[model samples]
Target: MPAAALKPKPSNEPLPTQSTAKRPVPLDTPYAPVAKRPLPPGRPREWYVTHNRRLKAMRLAIALLDSGVHQPDQARDETIRSAARLIGVHPPSETTCHMVRALMRYAR
Candidate 1:
């Protein structure tokens, strides 16, 4: 027998793929975080008030849905009112109603 034939056979399996083909990023390049643009002078207060209201309503809806107290229904006004009361929001604003509806969709 020849020497090559006596030797072990080469592997038929392919080599593992790598993710290192991309070039390394330059260390000297500026990489500062994106700066937030300032809001218009008189709009900040109202913007924040509205934003906070929406956030509060979302939180309330999540809590109500998680508690399993209010089952999902397409025409359930009482559920929305209960959720509004749970979050201490009076009059159940449009934002609160929207959040409640969104929560119901997920719950169902």
Candidate 2:
């Protein structure tokens, strides 16, 4: 093979100038002033506990559904409810159950 054939093709584009180059924003730089919104009111301890429980249940349900150990249709509701109970979600609320079911359906 000829040495000329090994040479890289040259680009037609002009090199970028300092004015055209994009520089990273400095850490000390202040961004545009964003409107500050008041924080929402906090919930009760029970609410937090319930919320955590629901999240745990949702995560567990997704894992179980993805495991493929069970059919998507057969005994799905019962399985989710049982998983929730095992995960210390107590008697899972209707909303929690519904959310779990929806997640299972969507995942499949």
* Cα RMSD, each candidate: 14.5, 14.3
lDDT (Cα, 0-100) at 19 in candidate 2: 54
lDDT of 2 by residue, 6-108 (tens): 9999875546753533544343332233355653468787877776666755665654554443444553556666664544446666666666666666766
Q: Which parts of model 2 are misplaced by more than 4 Å? A: 1-54, 66-72
The digit string of per-residue lDDT tens for model 1 on 1-108 reads: 889989998775545774543635443343343345654566668787777676666655665654565655532566667655655556466666776677666766
Q: Which number leads on TM-score?
A: 1
Against the true structure, what is each candidate's TM-score?
0.41, 0.39
- Give the Å error, residue 9, model 2: 43
Q: Model 2 residue 18 lDDT?
A: 36
Q: How does model 1 fare in lDDT?
A: 0.60
* Model 1 TM-score, 2 decimals: 0.41
